[model samples]
Target: MRSFINKKVQTIKPSGIRKFFDIASEMEDVISLGVGEPDFDTPWHIRDEGIYALQKGQTFYTSNAGLMELRKAITETLSAKYDLNYSPEKEVLVTVGGSEAIDLALRATLDPGDEVIFTEPSYVSYLPCIQLADGVPVAIPLKEENEFRLTAEELRAAITPKSKVLILSFPNNPTGAIMLKEDLEAIAEIVLEHDLMVITDEIYAELTYYDEAKHFSIAALPGMLERTVYINGFSKAYAMTGWRLGYCCGPEEIMREMIKIHQFAIMAAPTTSQYAGITALRNGDADVEAMRESYNQRRRFLMHELERIGLPCFEPFGAFYVFPNISEFGLSSEEFAMQLIQSQKVAVVPGTAFGESGEGFIRISYAYSIQELKVAFQRLELFVEELRARKQV
Candidate 1:
């Protein structure tokens, strides 16, 4: 019975982030900065809307494409934020989450042996999703000197006749790097030159902290909207992770095929969540800003503390995580993470969870409270001191 399982699924590596977090979960006392979600509870207004929907017996399935009201809200929000527009009827489909949208986009587009190029040190799903869709996954290593941003030159270098799609994950998960308008403009030219379509995961788009330049979408570029599948959700921005709601917008031809697969597979996203999502998109701006400011404060504190403790970390201006170089401590990212958990009772994610390019670094999330962060760093300081002393011995 075990042998009858799909070999492709069996051979895939387990998520490194979850592996250590599971271990820490069993312990008595652990200060974890490993989970990539908002520490805040979902805003009361949004929860009240969901409660209202349930009271009104909205437990039934929405349209296979999702609620028209939610879809309309999706179009309005995208237009307001990124200047990208889509028709609710034919061009937008709400999925389980941004993760589902990624899978849907890949399955709808890729033929077996088609190539999908993505940046390394990205979220965990891109490679596995491409492989599951039977597309070849190509990783373009992002450089720290470039602040971990994907450059146009890298895009041009990775192109081939087989390259069919690019997975653009920005305001990135572990790295917290974002692409500005000029940065996106340069890449748009190369994408046009290569004749590639894109699956842009902008789930973290609203959480950016860069004061000088705001988050920009490549899909908003001239001539690119038709060629891009844009993904976003309420999880990060509205502190709505448990709600499991997300939406995708793209050309009608692509979206039509995606909705077919989604219809049979998921049928529809949660009706209650769809109702909640409509409220989130309409009234959650102030809530998002409050949470973003909180995360930014913790981010600044962690950055300064890591510098004082002699860990050179890349300064991130987006998202809520910091990728710090831990090479000087003479340990692999996994080793440092495990030993820290055992020795100091603190948990952070190993950067290698993202990709091999993330070796010698760890990802510390700033999504926790300031009190928890303060305690976690205190443990981290002790852990580093002990490691340094042992290396000397």
Candidate 2:
């Protein structure tokens, strides 16, 4: 059986994010903040749409590219939000999730040994997905001092002639870092100079804390619409994770190839989910705003409480997470996370689980309730006090 496994697949490790929580699951009164899932239920209107579709007996398949109306809805949302334009007929693809869209984009665009540059500590899937697609993974270590935004210099330094695509995720997962327009403009210049392509993951777009600008997509930058693949979904914004629907837009030539792979592999996204998605995009603004406001309140509370406990976390303004520096305790990221869970009954992910660059940090999700967070922090503060006393000894 070991011999039957593909060599590339064999090299992959199990997700470090799930490891601590799986143990915590069996324990009583454990507060697990390891998973990044939103606490919100699927917005009532979206759920209603799904139920209505089922009631109408819409259980059949959509086209391989997904429902045309859903694709059109996606395009309209992108245009209204970020000034991006795409032909729903040719450039848009509906996928099972933002995750599936990511896989399809990689498979369609990468050739064997082509290099794909992405930053770490990023979402865990990027490296494994690149390898599964036979693309070389070139990981650039993003700096905490730089707030984890991928700098033009860092990107430029990593590129070689073999580089084919760059994966950018902002309002970033794990770190919650965001790139401003000026930051992206610098990166865009480097990308154009090298003739590189990008797969920008903007699943956290609507959750940004900015009042005036909102989330800015790299694809909206001048001359970038044709060179970038934009991936977004209903999961993060509308709490539609189990609905399992996401969409991608890119150059029609690339999307045509992606559709072929999706056709052979997935056929179509769930017809019911697509119907719900159309409702989500069109009429879910107020629901999203209410959710975003709640998340923002949680985010600020977590930051303040973590600081009160002396954890020294960088302020994260985008996603619902805080990556606090835990190095002074002299424990490795894994050791810190494990011992904390074992001793205090609170579980958070080791930053090193994201990549080597995440050493000396730990990711705590704020998506859980304020009551949960308050209790969890009290335990964490006690754990920190014990560590300090041990250091004195």
Candidate 3:
């Protein structure tokens, strides 16, 4: 019998984050800070909307582009939140989550051997998605001293004549780093100079804390709207991860191409999810505000506790995760995470799961309840103390 795995598929390793999560699952009394999900249940009002849609027997598939109402809601939200305007009919494509949006964007735009430039310590999907699309991924490592932010110089250095797209995720995953307007302005200059297409994932746009820095969309910058594909979803802000609904907005030409792929692959986003997403957009502002405030509180608490435990973490400006330097522990990120889980029953993802630049750090999510966070922090403190007593730190 012949082996059947594709050569490309065989080259990809399974997600490092998921590997640890599987290990953590079998351990007794484990308190996980590993997953990057909101702990809140989907708000009752949104649930009622889904239920009402079901009760009305409205289970048919929506249009390939999703419901016009939901698309319009997204258009208005984009204008209100980011000052970027997009047409609901021609410029928006609903997807099965930001994950699908990402896949569609890369597939529609890339040809084999095309280069996609993105920063390291980002969401894990970018490299694999690029590879799946037969695009080459060029990773620009962000510096720890710069708080894991991607600088314009780094962006400029990463681009080559083969560069087809630049993938940017801010309010970043695992690192909680966000780019300020000035930083984005500098990057916008580089993008224009290189004539690069930009795919920006701003799923955590509403979760910004610390500085009052508003989210800057590359599409909103000069000469960018025509070349930028903006991706966002209700998962982080609306606490609707299970809804599996997200959308992409961009120039009509690119959006139409993305829609062609989506229509063929997915048909449309979930009908019930589209309906509930409308409610999430129309009346979920208060819920988003409340959730953001709670997350900010937890973020501050986690930063303080990590520092108190001798883990010097950069102050995160967005997202619900903190990446703390654990180099003092004299263990690799994976080893530290493994020992922490085994000894203290506390689960956190090794920062190296994000990228090579994250090797000396560990990512702890603060999306849990305050009490649960306190318990985890206490365990972590003890674990660090024990390591120090053993001459590990």
lDDT of 3: 0.91
List per-prediction Cα lDDT, in the order shown. Answer: 0.93, 0.93, 0.91
lDDT of 3 by residue, 1-393 (tens): 226878887888788889888988998888999988999999999999999999999899999999999999999999998889999989998899999999999999999999999888878898899999999999998988998888877887888999989999998998999888888899989888888999999999999985666777777888888899999998999999999999999999988999999988889999999999999999999999999999999998988888777889889899999999999978999999999999999999998888888899999998899999999999999998998899943
TM-score of each: 0.99, 0.99, 0.98
Candidate 2 regions with alpha-carbon error over 4 angstroms = none
Clashes of each: 0, 0, 0
TM-score of 2: 0.99
Candidate 1 at 170: error in angstroms? Answer: 0.8
**Candidate that beats the other on TM-score, 1 or 3, i.e. the better one:** 1
Model 1: per-residue Cα lDDT over 1-393, one tens digit each: 979999999979999999988998999899989999899999999999999999999899889999999999999988998899899999999999899999999999999999999999989988899999999999999999999999989989999989999999889988998888999999999889889998999999998988887788999999999999999998999998998999999999999999999999999999999999999999999999999999999999999999999999878989899999999977899999999999999999999999999998899999999999999999999989999999999
Off by over 4 Å in 1: none
Count of clashing pairs, candidate 3? 0
RMSD of each: 0.8, 0.8, 1.2
Residue-level lDDT tens digits of model 2 in 269-348 = 99999999999999999999999999999988988898788888878879888999999999999999999999999999
Q: What is the lDDT of residue 334 in candidate 1?
A: 95
